[model samples]
Target: MDRQEKRAFVAFLAEVFASTSIVIVTENKGLTVADVTELRRRIRATGSTYKVAKNRLVSRALEGTQFDGIAPLLKGPTALSWGADPAAMAKVLVEFAKTNENLVVLGGALGSQTLDASGVKALAELPSLDELRAKLVGMLNTPATRIAGAVQAPAGQLARVFGAYSKSEAA
Candidate 1:
């Protein structure tokens, strides 16, 4: 890569680092092209991207950034998988690793917090952003639903009483 290309790539990495909420680094040494492509596809499906960047450039981009903690793991043939949702990306990467041993999970970063391989795995087990949001909505709607049910109960009881009274009079 030329100087201009390198600079552009560094700039791009910097922007990606800033936008992403989490980044999981991996050592993809023996992964075949097809394996890497499939991994990238799965990661992209979760609204994340996987990039194999030069460690030097990656280190340079991470300078003065929140992801600086991950600099130590930037050694070797590293591929970065990052996204706005930490759990989602971690889930994808961990699942992929389970099937492909070639992709070694080095470690990662969630903002300023550094995570080891197991930490990243733990993150993968958490409920996703969408799932959490749905649960919160369900929790919020529960009270309103109970309120509606309570409001209708008295009328239902009154109608049942009137029906019984009418039957007794007819008899």
Candidate 2:
């Protein structure tokens, strides 16, 4: 890229680093275009983005940012994947690395915290934000449902009793 283009790209990276919650660094050594395309598709499906940038450019982007801790992890042929949901992003990288050996999980930063590869894997194992929200909604709804059932049971029994009494009186 030309000087102007490189500067613009660095500026863009800086903006991204400022806004993202998590940034995962990976060594995409020998991944084919198809593999990368598929990886990008999977990541994008979860509202995340994957980028391959020069180490120098990425380091420039990391300057004065909370993600600067990850600069050391940006060695050879590295790529970055980031998103608002840490677990979801980590999960995608870890799972993709498992399937494709060429894609190596180096490490990452979650906000101001730097994570090792194992830490990234652990993050991946946690339930995603959406999953956690769904679980919370289920937990909340269950009690209300049980309460409604409990409240209706007595009324239903009373109606049955009144019906039995009327039939006996008629008899």
Candidate 3:
């Protein structure tokens, strides 16, 4: 790329780093275009993004950003995937790396915290934001349902008792 284009890319990456909550770096040593395309598709499905970039340009983008700690992990042919949800991004990378040996999970940064490959894997194991929200909603709804059932049980029993009394009185 020319100087202007490189500068523009660096600016764009810097802005992305500033906005995103998670950034995962991977070494795509021998991944084919099809593999990358598939990876991108899966990541995009989760509202994340994956991009292959020059280490030097990435380093420039890391300057003064919260992700600067990941600069050391940017050696060789590396790509970055980032998103608002930390678990979602890590899950995609870790799962893809499991299927594709060529894609190595180097490391990443969650906000200002730098994570090793193992840390990234651990993050992946955690439930995603949407999953956690769903679980929370379920938990909340369960108590309300139980409360409704408890409230109705006494009324139902009372109705049954009144019906039994009326039948006995008629007899």
- TM-score per candidate, chains pooled: 0.95, 0.96, 0.96
Residue range 37-127, candidate 1, lDDT tens digits:
8998888888999999999999999999999999999888999989888898999999989999999999999989999999999999999
* TM-score of structure candidate 1: 0.95
Count of backbone collisions in candidate 3: 0
Q: For candidate 3, lDDT tens digit of each residue in 1-171?
A: 999999999999999999998899999999999999999999998899999999999999999999999999989999999988889888998999999999999999998999999999999999999999999999999999999999999999999999999999999
lDDT of 2 by residue, 94-169 (tens): 9999999999999999999999999999999999999999999999999999999999999999999999999999
CA shift at 82, candidate 3, in angstroms? 0.6
Better by TM-score, candidate 3 or 1: 3
User: In lDDT terms, how accurate is model 2?
Assistant: 0.96
Candidate 2 has a TM-score of 0.96
Q: How does model 3 score by TM-score? A: 0.96
Kindly report which residue pairs in candidate 3 clash with one another: none
